[model samples]
Target: MKGNSSSLRVSLRLLSAGLVSEEVIKDDTKLVGGSGLSLCDSNDNSKKSETNKALRNHQVLLAAHLEEAAELAAMIQGLSWALKLVVKSIQFFCDDDSIILDYVTDKVAPPNESIVVAKLLKQLALLQTSLTSCQTLPLQRSDDDINSSSLIKLARDAIASQTTWHTNTEEYETCPDCYAHVSPRHKLEVRSGYFHPICFTCIRD
Candidate 1:
């Protein structure tokens, strides 16, 4: 995720030695978390040319109103996945967000509660202790590096293949048309098919 937005896409890579594993994680306020991993190994010199396909794309959801919060949440989720894969050192590469980057790298205290949840702060603290190295760096958009561009394409492709869920919970519901969270206070309209809820913005449009 990037800029002053509520939701965006994330690209993550797991690099071990010279081998690389990749994933595109999509973020939204209305979704939940799911991820997978793929590992590649060389068994024969002749098979070294073969590549292991990237693993499953991830969908991470958080109850956030700012893109910074969503971005931090994505980092947390990605770190958790890395830990599961027995990775002890991690370096995060994200769009320039100095405040969040400083907090993640321990250059400063926790960020504001509004931009970073208190609960998530605690989670990040714990994750930090679990890893030997957890550092953050600004992503480089350079001619020599095509990783960022490729990851963006991967994210778009993943989104095209998936459909949003239209369901209701006690606190919030998802608008079938826009796929944004519909808070209880927002006026909702019930559509004919499956009785899915639609938000006023979608209704107006």
Candidate 2:
């Protein structure tokens, strides 16, 4: 797929063998997911409806990895969902070289391949159809990077809990630029720790 420098960037980190964390950082603000946190942690019943609405609008699937290659498969699944959420193109970063090669280079799978490989291929196809342009690259191995370390911590939490973390409506925050309270759909974040909500208006601007 073609690469667009203006497209939103999403960082996908494999926390553990079975856990993954996805994050978008914008203007010093961070939006995090796949932490396995509940959405309805609040006691107010009035907000429950709002939370539900958010849940329906922003959905992130959390699944446990059963096979060795499940992490790559899960990443592909995440990309497929992201394509539906954002209008502009998206760039995905992950540390797995094998998975990157599998998707970027159209390699034919041998007969009797593992089920995880098959699933990855299927999700990759879906992602291609949904995105106008996409790019997947390897993540820099850096222990000092705050974003990288934070994602690792989130993944550790998910693995310890042994559960899948889905999108919760309450997780949405107001975009700093648009001043509208919405889910994390189409948000933008920078490597310098800047984060803001991205709406159609902001994207156009």
What TM-score does each of the candidates earn? 0.44, 0.41
Top candidate (TM-score): 1
* Candidate 2 lDDT, 95-187, residue by residue in tens: 544443455445546235454455655666666667666555455557325544544444344332221123454455445465554455555
Superposed by TM-score, candidate 1 places the C-alpha of residue 18 at a distance from the truth, in angstroms, of 25
Clashing residue pairs for model 2: 25-189, 26-189, 26-194, 26-195, 27-193, 27-194, 27-195, 28-193, 28-194, 28-195
Give the per-residue lDDT of model 1 (tens digit) for 1-205.
Answer: 1112111111223311111112121234323222222111212111111111222223113334344444455456556656655656655555554466566556677545453345555676788688777665665447214444344334333332232433454355455567566563574665654223467998788
Q: Pairs clashing in candidate 1?
A: none
Off by over 4 Å in 2: 1-68, 96-100, 107-111, 143-145, 161-205
